[model samples]
Target: MRGKRTTTGAAVMIGALAVTGLTFAPTAAAVTPTTATINASCGLFGGGAATLTATQNGTSATITLSSTAIKTPLALAADSITSKLTMVKASGGTTVFSGKKNPAMAAQSPVTVGPLSGTVASGDSLEFYGGSLQMTIFGISVTCTASAKQSPGPFVFD
Candidate 1:
């Protein structure tokens, strides 16, 4: 009976050590991209509304702007539009990543931004600014421009 008790205690200690070792074992660091989709209303004069999808991997990011219709009082014929998207640091208001896209009417497309010189850390803000649309309506060409408000975000990067 004594011999059996000693053997059982030894086995229990070994099992405990194995579990402890596993708990402290080093794990391979994984680099996974974080993605966020943000939507904002630009009002009638600005462009109605817009949706932006941003993906961040390390220091690089890709931004996609879904085609949003512009609303104006004018009877428009054709439009040439471009929008610039930026990731700004919330603390300092520094733009970390910037990219532009000239989207077709009612189309969704991805615009790859950059291997950003500045890091887009946690707790950053994003803005869609410098938007211009050139429209040829009623045989006259007109250019309309507007800037979207800065969206508060933590455009996460893993």
Candidate 2:
């Protein structure tokens, strides 16, 4: 009876470890191509080429946008840009990621914001062309939209 109990305990321990390993393995794979490009238009604030970078760990993900083409109208303080990124899912509907993440910048400096957080799923394809990026700075609101489809196609998450 003692020998049987020892064997059972060992089997349970191995099973638990296997489960834990499996749960964590996919998180390391990350989303592919990590970076995408878009030609954005922001009206009076001006528009230009922008880079969107992404990272994923399991269902959690983040995206950051930076554009030398778009310049800040004034110097900004860190975490002062109230921004929301809306993306169209290939399957339909939209997902929005909003955050206040920015580095302090001098007047007319390139605009950049976020490592904004959102939830994503395996096989999810998202694009910015049909959506918009809206940002609020110093009581003034600026909106940017992609002029065409993002390069290298839509972001396909793993």
Give the Cα lDDT of each candidate: 0.43, 0.90
Per-residue lDDT tens digits for candidate 1, residues 39-112, read 44333334444444566555555555443353444332223333334454445554533333333332222222
Candidate 1: C-alpha RMSD to true structure equals 9.8
Clashes of 2: 0
State every prediction's TM-score relative to the real structure: 0.38, 0.81
The C-alpha RMSD of each candidate to the native structure, in angstroms, is 9.8, 3.7
Best by lDDT: 2
Off by over 4 Å in 2: 1-28
